[model samples]
Target: MELVFKTEDAISKLLTIKIEYFDSLQIYLLNDLWVHEMEGDFFLKEVESFKPILKRQLKYGLNPEEYINKVCKRIKEKLEFLEEHKVGSIEFLQFYCKQIKPITEITTFPSLGTDFYDEFKTSLKECKTDETDLYKFLVRFAEGNFNYTKYHEFSIGCLSYVIWNYYCALTELYRFVSTLQENAPFVDFSNLDIEDNKKCTEHLKTDIKVHFNQDKISVAHLFLFLLKEKHIVFDCKDERNNELQLKRFIEAHLTYLNINGDRVPIRSFNREFSEARASTKVQKHKQFINKFIYGLEQYRDSLKD
Candidate 1:
């Protein structure tokens, strides 16, 4: 985090993280994140504490009024630009999220369907992690009926002081990515400045291609599998309604990666996923993928012990 503010790309990175964090927080709100095993008061209280600390740090490191004004103004303009381009309202996005709920919900059915996202499941198996058994993790997510490892008080808590807001943002962003949103354009690239525009355009461009690496694909599959598993048990009918578990799931994954010294393949996974979302012509979805991935990359890069 200190490095982010000291680098030449500070402002760009700040804007990037700000937007990314915004998407994560918004997604958290959208999914009613607190309902998923987190104490509502505790979670909300934690989030509420971030802004003041961030503001003080920004003011200390930047021209108090100028940088503050610039950041706030840019965010407002970017959001306005998105709105003008017909990015759907939060309510609409939530509706879209709800519409996809059935695919996962059926996993809890008395007889699991034959065609239950097998491709996603296969992706998980392909990505072998020495640190943790992803197969068992995926199965745990699918079942969503067990007392899970408690990470908030441990591994996640062991992360650096700079990680609180970022952890909140990145985890929530992953939740949204797993569920996916409607196929609609989520950003307006034309209105952005050259550098930012290129950043946006690069995400949407299909001209450039890379050789698909199996490890990368496998990592993506694991994330996708975890995400789908969450949806299946995200909302339940009985006492387990909105069964809280994604946070713990992510904490466990991060712990494994940290212990094994593995670069969280989240960056590549997000790029591939972002490209796919960009292709869907949903500006809002693209905007989210881009921003969330940016923030997530920063978070992962800062994970030094």
Candidate 2:
């Protein structure tokens, strides 16, 4: 996927916007804690160290409840702006980063970590300027050091360091949201019968057997004949041609067996079908055509008997 930001300035501005969002959220959480009277000395000390003004009870004579309300309003406005501009949420940013191949290297680093920097540098060089600029902006937003030399070489080691931290923050954000609510509603399977479930599954797996000679007439030839004769009509509403629909249906079902009692693999079936379909000799073969007709005649005769 193309990088979202086109220009370097746009990338920089996006990073600034994200940083402001993170800062706002942090402040909101601190005020929330203060309002609930849950702020301890250690918490206050940490808050002061991180951003001194948040220790409003001691350092600043601000009402925690008011701060929380104000922060909530500001967050709502920011969300509206994000919606309007299609700036995307943190999840979208993570997904976009994942789509970029080089960025994925940041997450799957080797255990040794020695060759990681060299690999990252090589990958970064091959990346588009917009991708690198966005990455560099994210690093800066995450409080990562991004030092570049006169020769346009970036600090690969620093890039790796900051990117790992940024990735971790994204992970923690997901974990935080996951903790807030259940992903799916609880279901009690206590009344279910295990034996019946097993029987149902086994019934579904039962294969449909058909008559044909694997050596004389390949599975693909038989499949094409059946489809052409309307013996295996696809129960689909798609506008795709019969060949494509049959291929997809066979692949999905995987329950058909050739006359030799061997499962028909989709890959081999496709190859055989392509070759057979393209050959006029195969289509016009008298013996081959007769074999299928003979089988159908025998089946019909047996039914009448």
Candidate 3:
């Protein structure tokens, strides 16, 4: 009984399980409207409670009313509007489905095709440390060549953003890593016990009081090490490598190659992102969308990509 206070409440963890339900609902709502033909109480039963619980779950920081307005009210109004204008026919159903298309409808980033993502993952799987200058710097830094310290802060900052949207990725990855129990056959954790073993691993900054072991794939360095094997330049260069630049480069070579035209928000191409003359109006629109998709990329690039 004494060890009980040291643990998170069982009900909190149970509530955490509800996050998957809310996450799927949010993703479904992203490209779809509440234009479904269903029982009248669907909103009350399926969605109304989700807002309150999810808001609490996320510890929502801004626009406290956003979930209520965009999700709860948006669906409520849509259902009412649709009910008043309800029409029944083959074309109407098709149109309804079309209007509420899922992002998965494309099956992949449009220009990138379905296989590019798979290929990219394969590339990542094949990556190794010897291929990266940063890895070499890390190695020598470990070996007592202190010059690596000169680039320490700069490198960590660059590495942080290299995997674009990693903060969100970590949320998803946490689900996987948390399920990894002690002494898993594949998990070679010599130093996994360092610190609390429950906090984020830092690459630098001694004050953080947490770090990852070599076997920690969750560490950004190992991920970057894998990325390096494919010659994908994610190293945060002094002023040359921005997220958009790397994104465009990857899209061009991996996604848009042999496709004969750039695409939008999902798939795009440009061997070089900064070359201002090489884009169409759609490309320009997508540039805006991509900037919006990961605005941090643009802001950071502006600062010193």
Candidate 4:
């Protein structure tokens, strides 16, 4: 619905917002601010023409969390630099923040998710919006606008936008986060920089790549019923098949890694594999493929010695 560009720093009071929402939303905002400041046209156009690329990312890419994380890191670096350098002046920064306001004028109903996403695929066939050109306005608004509320609404649309591409990217379902560590890295808790969030989102996409590269559960369509949807399911026959396949694959891969003393590669793969592994359901077989690739690399390294 809008795109508001603003900033606040240590010298300047940071804009405060209540956090009961998703952390990614905040990260996205900060990154957006950064991207607009730096890449300007490219960034704006990205939001304007998001469908194709986002769709590609969702289909043949990495995990979303990982992508976002990298972006978060990069954006933080840039913000820190900007805060330290103050390319212009404190008055300018504060002025920038003061100048922009949220745009909430364009009101519209929610979009249909099912036709595009697996979970919602069968639930709704089409998304009906008002005939007042809300979608077109959104594209134009995202491309060049200075309204916070509009950006906020625009961001909500972004979530749906990202989800649609996600559906198009793969046949099955998956998750990028599970059993998060007690001390994970800190990310932008404010929705300040749109670019940072975009980069972070893009970086997190790799998890999907790791999945597809590994290829066991090759199912093409999956639906998520809850927030943490790791697409895995098994029947009586599947249990036996899984046990045998897993046993053979594990033995071969792990043996190669251990014997070759490729602990680094093996351990990394182990972590990735565990992260992707589902207790009750199945996902892409790419997990194992990644492990095998590591194993092979390690084996080749050992051969050199």
Number of the predicted model whose lDDT against the real structure is largest = 2
Scored by lDDT, model 2 comes in at 0.35
For candidate 3, what is the lDDT?
0.29
Model 1 lDDT per residue over 62-87, tens place: 43334444544444344333323322
- Relative to the true structure, how large is the alpha-carbon lDDT of every model? 0.33, 0.35, 0.29, 0.29
TM-scores of the models, in the given order? 0.21, 0.27, 0.16, 0.19
Whole-model lDDT, candidate 1?
0.33
Q: Can you give the lDDT of residue 220 in candidate 4?
A: 15
Error of model 2, residue 180, in angstroms: 27
Candidate 3's C-alpha runs over 4 A off are 1-44, 55-60, 87-305
TM-score of 2: 0.27
TM for candidate 3 is 0.16
RMSD of each: 22.5, 21.4, 25.1, 20.5
At residue 31, give the lDDT of candidate 3. 15
Tens digits of per-residue lDDT for model 3 on 35-145? Answer: 111222332232233323433322323332332233333332332332223211122223344444333342322121124224323443565335343333234223232
The candidate with the higher lDDT, 2 or 3, is: 2
